[model samples]
Target: MKSKKIPERLESKRLLLRKLNHTDAPGLYANIRDKEISRWLSGVPYPYPKDLALKFVLTAIAKFENKKRFTFGITIKGIKKEAVGVISLEKVDYKNKNAMLGYWIGKKYWGKGYMTEAVKEVLSFGFETIGLHRIYANVYSENPASERILRKFGFIFEGVEREKFFKEGEWQDYLTYGLLKKEYSKAM
Candidate 1:
């Protein structure tokens, strides 16, 4: 399987999974900086500062230099020029041809199927464009919405741990889900 030498932006029916920009800090910060939103997310800290957001965008750009995996700033197609969510591929193993998918969306947009749509677009990119063999999503057991999105993406519930995460000052269970190239190919 061959990875695209150049990173490609993916577009779905309602989204443009484009590259993140430093200018996106203001809009992204507005939606993602709160503890309510960042609670379960591992690296994104509560009360995320503008400086940190800028750093995030910078790091996103830097990922392109390596060329195997990338993240996107999720923007709605018809809406104003702003990011309502962000999604990405991480821990890509080119030899194994796999990557773990992750995402976050604005709270107001929850229950609208936005996250599922975005996940589908990226998974399609991984399997179709990037020639990847597998993709997976992990979530805290309490995050039913994320679990729902992965299920809708055709990921199967694989396993769970007793105390796989420690977030917001407490320990919690982590639910792991995964989809294989074989499974996705069969579904297609």
Candidate 2:
């Protein structure tokens, strides 16, 4: 299959999702360093070292360039340089036309509908722009907010994986949600 060029930036009513850059390190560090944020995320370390943010930014850039993953930094309209969160389509499988969706916003920005807006934009890109067949997300069962966002987009609850992740000194169940292109088109 031929590759499609992913856009460097996507815009929503109140948010701008753009490719990660070197200058995003500070903002990424500030938002991701919170223990509350890191606990929900499987990969992020608890302390969330300052330097790791830069490393992550650089790695995201490389992955974007290689078309391996698409990671967008979430920023509000006026303040484009300061990222409040991140949303990504990772583990992209061009042959299968599927990808996994992952996202998180800072504690300060939660409950304001920023993630819901961002997810809508990214799902559009993945299904319509990139021509993906399916997009799925795995959320820890403890995170009802994340599950609600997926439900709003018409993602079906596929199933649950028992003891899928060990975070914060205990095992956690993962609730899988999936949306096919047909489902997205119908909802839209």
Candidate 3:
């Protein structure tokens, strides 16, 4: 597959999405370690490991350079430079022009519409910058809030993946959502 150019920084009305690095470890760890934030998240470990944030940051940097994935740390503009959330487009399939979208915000920042702004910018980057034709998201059945966000962004509910993952100590089902480039255009 050919290499893609992923922007290092993207700006929205109230947030800045930038490439995550080692410097973000402490802030990322602190924000994501909250049970409220990590509970519904699939990959994140409960009682998150002390070193996991730094490891993820390093992996994100390497993945970007490899053109395999693009992960951005989300921070509020002019409020603090530290990351309060994370978003990513991973498992890129250049042959099919598709990728999976994943994101999570700190519990303290919930209900603020910060994630909505971040998602908009990332969607634009995925469709316009990286030329992806489809972006999909998998939301756990229990996470209605995330599903609502997906719906608001024009993502169609495709189907459910039953017992798809073992997360937070139990098996969980996932509600799959997909948004095509055309659908996003129409939404806009």
Per-candidate clashes come to 0, 0, 0
Candidate 1, residues 120-153, lDDT tens digits: the string is: 8888878887888889877887888888778776
User: What would the per-residue lDDT of candidate 2 be over residues 1-188, giving only the tens digit for each residue?
Assistant: 33656799999999999998899889889889998888888899988888999999999999999988999999999755677789999998999999999999888888999999999999999998888999999988888898999999999999999998899899999889999999999998
How many backbone clashes are present in model 2? Answer: 0
Candidate 3 per-residue C-alpha lDDT over 84-172 given as tens digits, one digit per residue, 9 for 90 to 100: 88999999899999999999988888999998899999999999999999999988897888988899999999999899888767898
Rank by lDDT, descending?
Answer: 2, 3, 1
Better of 1 and 3 by lDDT: 3
What is the C-alpha local distance difference test score of each model? 0.81, 0.91, 0.90
Better of 1 and 2 by lDDT: 2
Q: Which scores higher on TM-score, 1 or 3?
A: 3
- Candidate with the greatest TM-score versus the true structure: 2
User: How well does model 2 score by local distance difference test?
Assistant: 0.91
Model 3 clashing residue pairs (backbone): none
TM-score of 2: 0.97
| Cα deviation of 77, candidate 3, in Å | 0.8
Tell me, what's the RMSD of every candidate?
1.6, 1.1, 1.3
